[model samples]
Target: MQKISTCLWFENQAEEAAKFYVSVFGDSRILDVSRFGEGGPGQAGQVITVEFEIEGRKFMALNGGAPANFTEAVSFVVDCSDQAEVDRYWSALTDGGAESMCGWLKDRYGVSWQIVPSVLGSLIGGPDPEGAQRAMQAMLGMQKLDIAALQTAYDG
Candidate 1:
């Protein structure tokens, strides 16, 4: 078992969200699920917790109900090898969610995600400070990162 797995709190969509996430990521699976007990806080037989993994990273979803909600404070970052990968994740994640600047998005379940190109770090933190600034400016103008545009900006 991996130590220090992330746990997400949901109103009651733990299982549903887990299934959706498993479908989105190319490498992911549902490890296990635990249902509520007769005297538990949640409805009996309802999903209490869902254990899953995405690209080998472990996560748990809890049906904590009301009060507990998702915010932009925390988000999952997906590193894409190219524009295709970025497009895929961006489309999947933003189907029923809102888009934010700089490749950030809120999924249907209100979870924030960052769909970033693998080269983003190098482009934005490269040795050439001017190129890095250009890349940063390009990224700031996009919702879903355009890898080609970023590359152009970096090369400028």
Candidate 2:
């Protein structure tokens, strides 16, 4: 059991969200699921919480009541090794959600996710400030990050 875990509040789609997330990340799985009992906050037999993992990081999805206040203040950043990995997650996550610039997307549950390429971090953390600036500029205009394009900008 991890000492710290991220908990997500949902209207009633915790199980669905957990399955969706586990399907997206190859190195992830659904650990456990707890159902609401009689007289609980949620309907009996309904999923109350779902424990899942994405690339080894544990997270819990809570099927709480109607969302009163949930926003994109915090998000998960996925560092993909290639464009294929990015595309896989981007497509699955943005299917019933919205897409934002610079590899940002909101899942159906209103969770913001940054599907970044591993190389992007390298470019941004490069020794040459000019190269990093160019890469950053290129990233700013992109909705889905293209690893090749970022490399071109960084090498320019």
Query: Which numbered prediction scores highest in TM-score against the true structure?
Result: 1
lDDT of 1: 0.92
What does candidate 1's lDDT look like per residue over 1-156, in tens digits? 687889999988899999999999978999999997999776788888999999999999988877587898999988899999999999999989999999999999999999989999999999999999999999999999998899999999
Query: Least accurate stretch of 10 residues (summed lDDT) in model 1?
Result: 62-71
Q: Using lDDT as the measure, which candidate wins?
A: 1
Per-residue accuracy of model 2 over 67-92 as CA lDDT, tens digit each: 74556678889888899989998999
Full-model lDDT for every candidate:
0.92, 0.89
